[model samples]
Target: MMRSGLLLFFIGLAACSPPVTKSKAKIEEFRQYLEKSRTDDGVLLESRMLAGSNGLVWENSGKYQGDILLDDSQLEDLVADFAGVSNDNNRNAFVVANTRWPNNVMIFNYASNEFNNAQQNAIRTAMSWIEHFSCVRFRWRSNERVFVRMTGNPTGCYAHVGFSTAHPNRVLNLARNNHCFSHGVIIHELLHSLGFQHMHQTYERDSFVRINWNNIISGQEFAFTRFPRNQVNLHGLPYEYTSIMHYHNQAFSRNRQPTIVPLRSFSGTMGQMEQTSYWDWLRLRRHYNCPGAWNRNSEEIMKKEVERTLPLIKLNLPAPKQGLFTDEDNAYVRALNADTNNEDIVNEEAMDYEDSDNENNNFNEDIGNDNYEN
Candidate 1:
């Protein structure tokens, strides 16, 4: 009787199989699951320290293409592509159309007290570098509904691809724990937050360089996948060998072999995080539709704008209590005290500079010209 019951149970299960429509849905789900597993399983949860050919260091930020953070909609689009599902409308026709900030202003804040004076200066300097060629402006966060909140957490220096109305309060983390405070890395993350994708992953990349599949870390080959034409618009820019967004030859190499080999003879390094190339600036200008941005002096305009709007921001009343200090806190306090003491010294130096000859005060003339071969 027990054997008969078991046999009937098996027969009943076979008879109750899902219908054709349900089977099709189940197959799609399975395919999506496989794609997700394939893409995410190989991602390094811990940050990997990487150096460019120019000796500039950076850390891989997130799961998507190493550092690019994708929202749910974006991830779905990517997974669809991985599963060989063609999608014409992956949210917006152009990624920039909906992602670009209004009035070309990037309202932001030092979200945490983790950023030291030097780190803050480096962040500002990187933004200043972008401002030199584009109309994009950065400002201290105010009551604006949308803005970039920059925090120095131990989360490995990742940022959202661009501004989204749905994902307002966009975060751009510069990981203090990972030493992701370099000028170039900060600029790179800033570019990501500004809606730029990796240059090497452009759709036309195969013509420019060859990918050595054997050298790429197993399962991490997804990182080398090209962005489809619908996803990225190049705005008629030529394929640049020295784009800062281009990966170094040895990037993601398992055996330290060249993963990205240039087809054409190039004098400059593929990845130099030291500075943004001219093409970088040009693309940014075209993205923002601000060709007239280069007319103004960025430094003076930013200084004047900050001075005008800073005092208007309302201060927090009934300020929060001070928290307990860790060992790191003690070091931070020391640095803060030293910085406070240097204020007067810096003021005095500025006064001295005012009285000096213009020719002798060319110290900062090359401040924004800090570019390598890239």
Candidate 2:
């Protein structure tokens, strides 16, 4: 009788298993849909330069603040803020409420040929670093409806600010052979995709550092634009000069002179991309509402918290009501251009990110053209 009961249990488990053929078909269907969604119909709303380790890198015509690809409504909100017409002072962490990745998880996919093995490893290393410090987790794409598609376009490194609602399938381009594969650069671009903006762009930045506009390159001034205080939630933490997201002293300089001068003397390096500073990691944890993120050994504590909440995941516990220093529940940020009718410009390719070994031989030929320009 016991043998018969065990047999029945095993049979029940097999019956409950999902059909393999149907799953493969569904995945293939999504791949076809993604291919059809690729287009070049987007407008060149804004562009900004970034000071990577290889010196000043120009922005692609369609990017904002160096590499952020903004969608329609986000662009509208930013335009209004830029025009000094916006009265909506929602102080969430300079991020759109809905832009946060659901469940603090990030789903990603990349073409096999877009990046070489070293670059791919760098991407994983950066993701691992974030995972080690915060509650944010990364997973290679399966059948996720919304995910970041990393490309190896030679257009300099850039990413959409977050999970774009207007373009659910977003692309983050890390230009091949463009010095974009460094661990720090990978972390910087990944942070952008994770919805974090440049630290110097925060509204209260003027009090800490002075922007030397005269030293800035012409037509690149947009890169140094600031976010208004009302539009940003700083989490009451003091300005972080050592933030990985902070630009180097000579960022966007036309004459190799300093553009960002500190008002007060400080220890440590400014705009160091070596690793995410403590404050930088803290903001990310808070943004994701990671439990016990404020205390030491928080990462281990968070891991246990995740385990404890597994059975109760459906309950969706509430986040902290307000920040320790601020009066808001989350920080809110806004930006981009005002064009609403334009489509996105990323041309995403679909394939198994890990197993596929196709080589993009045409990548060199494709780089010579100025297709990335407006």
Q: Write the per-residue lDDT of candidate 2 for residues 1-374, one digit (tens) a residue.
A: 01100000000011111223335454455334323223332432222234222233423323455556655455544433433344344423222345667777888998766666555655665675577456687888999888999986655677766665556777777765535655567777777777777777766788999989998876566567665443344554568888777878887667878989999998888777655566676677766665544444433333433343232212211121221212222111000011221112111212122332223222333332323322
Every model's TM-score: 0.64, 0.61
| Per-candidate local distance difference test | 0.53, 0.53
lDDT of 1 by residue, 1-374 (tens): 01100000000001111222335465576445434532434333233453222122342544445555555555555445544443346333423346777777888887445565445555765675566445677888869888888865454666766667766867787665424655567777787777776777666788999999998876567667665454555655678778767777877777878888999998777887655665676567667765322332322332332233222111101101121011223332233224233322212211121232222122222322322221
Error of 2 at 332 (Å): 30
Candidate 2 TM-score versus the reference = 0.61
Task: State, as a TM-score between 0 and 1, how close model 1 is to the true structure.
Answer: 0.64
Residue clash pairs of candidate 2: 92-330, 92-331, 92-332, 93-330, 93-331, 93-332, 94-332, 94-333, 95-332, 95-333
Q: Single out the weakest 10-residue window by summed lDDT for candidate 2.
A: 3-12
